[model samples]
Target chain A: DVKVTQSSRYLVKRTGEKVFLECVQDMDHENMFWYRQDPGLGLRLIYFSYDVKMKEKGDIPEGYSVSREKKERFSLILESASTNQTSMYLCASSPNRGGGNTDTQYFGPGTRLTVL
Target chain B: GQQVMQIPQYQHVQEGEDFTTYCNSSTTLSNIQWYKQRPGGHPVFLIQLVKSGEVKKQKRLTFQFGEAKKNSSLHITATQTTDVGTYFCAYGQNFVFGPGTRLSVLP
Candidate 1:
């Protein structure tokens, strides 16, 4: 089975503190994504990386950045965390861009970040 | 921007009853995918539909992609406690998920 693992299940940070949420996939997928889940708002994309050392901003990439130094790992970083940034952060990976038949997206358990 | 929306953000149903959720996209999608995320768990892929007006079934669940490839639906034949979760429909490149329908199955 494809496995996606996040570094932390729960994290708390003070305002203005830097935070990092790490995600690692064992399937060697080429695409990785980070999203924040909120009630009623749904899953909003924060950032995504298609290849190592490459990243792109997503719909809600205001205070978030991502890094992909290795094919199996993707990291989401918050330069200066704010209370509004508290959310359930999710990480996902797919074999490739779902252009043909890449429908499946394996996800990690998620990190619930509490920016106080 | 490619966007998708799901209707009836929350649904409450009794066990043994049926439930259905709808997803609509702003643009024509190449394909549509369905996913289920249990409470406090990550999302898991359920099924995918490619062709226009395509229909696929998995056990008690039925998934359909509209003829316009801009809408889709997921119907569960008989609701069960285990069926309680958020159902998400995504359509676009790299499988973008919608807001999701949170289903509460009451015993």
Candidate 2:
């Protein structure tokens, strides 16, 4: 079974504070993604990394950055946390099939971030 | 970027009742995937349909892909309390997910 673990399950931060959400996958998948889920908004992609040091912006990447220094780890950085940034953060990883076919994503336990 | 739309933003059903959710796309899709997210839990992959007009079933749940590959539906027969959660339909390689249909099954 694939295991994806996040650094924190729940986090609280103050406005303008720097926040980091970490995700690690044991499957060594080549594709990793960061998403923020809000009510009625579904899961919106924030950033994704296809390989080490390779990053791509998703639909909503503002105020957020990603780091993929290693294959197993992906980090989401909140430049300066704001109340509007509070949402459930999810990390997913999928193996590279090297084709146009879509791969199934395995998700980690989400981190619910609260910005006050 | 592709858009996937799901109907019945919310549904409440009593135990043993049937429930269904629909997902539609403006343009044809190569494949579609379904996911379930329990309350306070992250979304989990349920199933994927690649072939058009394909139907797959798991236990009492049925998933169907439209012949046009532009729509899909998930149906759950005899709902159980454990089935309460949000159902999402995703499309495209980027996995653009729908807003999701929240299901509440009352025992």
Candidate 3:
């Protein structure tokens, strides 16, 4: 079975603090993504990495960045946490497809971030 | 950019009743996918529809894609306790899901 593991299931941080959320998928998928989910707004993409060192901005990417230094791990970074950023963060990975958005994405258990 | 919208943000039904959720998109879709996420759990893939006007079934669940490829639906024959979850429909070149329909089943 494919497993996508998150570094933390819950986190709390103070305003202006830098935060990191880590995700690892053991299935060797090449495409990974970060999204934030909130009540009413649903899930919005923040960043995605298709390969090591390659990244792309999604619909809502402000104040956030991602790292894909290795094939199995992806990280989401909040440059300066704020109360408005508190939400459930999800990490997803899919097999690489040269074709756009045509692959099946597997998701990890989400991290609920609470920024004070 | 693609836009996928789901209807009836929330639904409440009695066990053994039928339930359905609809999804519409602004543009034609190469494929449409469905997912279910239980409360406090990650979203899991339910099925994918590739052809226009396609319909597929999984036991008590039925999935349909519109003829124009811009809409889709998921119908449950008889709602059960296990069917309580948020159902999402994603339309795109790939498999990005949209806002989901949250279902609550009552005994």
TM-score of each: 0.96, 0.98, 0.97
Order of candidates by DockQ, top first?
A: 2, 1, 3
Flag clash pairs in model 1: none
Question: Which number leads on TM-score?
Answer: 2
lDDT of 2 by residue, B1-107 (tens): 46788999999999999999999999999999999999988889999999999999999999999999999999999999999999999887778899999999989
Between prediction 1 and prediction 2, the one with superior lDDT is 2
> Model 1, stretches more than 4 Å misplaced?
A97-101
Residue-wise C-alpha lDDT for candidate 1, range A76-104, written one tens digit per residue: 99999999999999999988744356647
In candidate 3, the residue pairs with backbone N, CA or C atoms under 3 Å apart (3 or more residues apart, or in different chains) clash, namely A101-B94, A102-B94
- Which CAPRI tier for candidate 3? medium
Q: Alpha-carbon error at A111 in model 3, in Å?
A: 0.4
User: Whose DockQ is higher: candidate 1's or candidate 3's?
Assistant: 1
Off by over 4 Å in 3: none
Query: lDDT per prediction?
Result: 0.90, 0.95, 0.90
Model 3, B59: alpha-carbon shift in Å?
0.6
